[model samples]
Target chain A: AQSVTQLDSQVPVFEEAPVELRCNYSSSVSVYLFWYVQYPNQGLQLLLKYLSGSTLVESINGFEAEFNKSQTSFHLRKPSVHISDTAEYFCAVSATTSGTYKYIFGTGTRLKVLA
Target chain B: SAVISQKPSRDICQRGTSLTIQCQVDSQVTMMFWYRQQPGQSLTLIATANQGSEATYESGFVIDKFPISRPNLTFSTLTVSNMSPEDSSIYLCSVEDLGRANYGYTFGSGTRLTVV
Candidate 1:
């Protein structure tokens, strides 16, 4: 079984400021990491994911996340955020061998971009 | 990623009633999953809908309460039986499209059920 933990419940930042959303997971075997964003009343959208190879992954919208094996962490970062980035971000983990294809999601971090 | 469409985007039903949510995908997918998100909480996997087989449910969820059916690879239905206020949440359907390396799962717009 895999579980994910997002450290922050809410983060407030000014427009154009940098932000980081911390995420940690617990799993014995290899796992796939993902970040999803959900706007109000909408479904989740895939922000990025860390599968194999390169530990660092990036999204088209200037968001990036690095998978740290030792720390069991995959924290999402953005150099400069815009007001459109304000939404609920979730970190998820799924076991590599588990054929169930179920992803355990974190509590979620609400990013509030103040203009 | 696959395009998913879910019906009954939102509804307010009375207690003891039932609501059936429908999900349709543009392409055939190997796996389809149903998830629930309570107010201010994260998503919880309810069950995995498989064609020609009983849906595999997770802990704390049962077929009696939430029945699922997948007639084909591109379509599935989830019925929330005996609705209660506790069942009020956003129900979403997701499909796994392994073609994309990073984006494997695509989600539906979700049905917001508010039991009164």
Candidate 2:
């Protein structure tokens, strides 16, 4: 079974400050990693995904994550954040092998950007 | 990206009643799933909605309590039977869009069901 673990439950960052949300996973087989953001009263939206060929995956909104296979970590990073970036982020993992296609989501990290 | 349209954004139902949530996708998808988000908790997948056959439910979830139906590739529905206070949660519909190298999932806004 594949499982995702988000280390931080809540993180507060000032505007223009760097932020990193940690995520780790446990899986026996190769897996795909993803980050999702959920704003207030909204559904979960995909931020970025690391499928293959790239250790670092980036989103259009200045968010990036690096997939480190040795460490079993895929941490999300941002050079600077804005007040609008305040949202709950989730780390999810799914198997690359065939037979199943269910995503295992982490507990979630709440990014509270203070102006 | 796939677009999912879910009905009844929020509903306040009395105990012993049942509520059905519907999800309509704009395009055909092979993977459609149902998830539940409880208060102050992470999203937990309820079941995988298959097009023709019976839905595959996760452990701890049963067909008698939460029945699911997928009539086509673009539509699915989930019904919560015998509503109770414990059933108060946000129900979301998810669909996957596979690309050549990568894929991402899209979700409905979610239906907030408050059982009283």
User: TM per model?
Assistant: 0.97, 0.97
Whole-model lDDT values for every prediction? 0.92, 0.93
- For all the candidates, what are their Cα RMSDs to the real structure? 1.1, 1.2
Point to the candidate with the largest lDDT: 2
For model 1, name the residue pairs that clash: none
Best by DockQ: 2
| Candidate 1 chain A worst ten-residue window by lDDT | A94-103
lDDT of 2 by residue, A61-108 (tens): 999999999999999999999999999999999785467666899999
The digit string of per-residue lDDT tens for model 1 on A1-108 reads 678999899999999999999999999888889999999889999999988899999999999999999999999999999999999999999786555455889999
Report the number of clashing residue pairs per model.
0, 0
* Two-chain DockQ for each candidate model: 0.83, 0.86
Q: Is the docking of candidate 1 incorrect, acceptable, medium or high quality?
A: high
With a 3 Å backbone cut-off (N, CA, C), the pairs that clash in candidate 2 are none
- Retained true contacts (fraction), each candidate: 0.68, 0.79
Candidate 2: which docking quality band? high
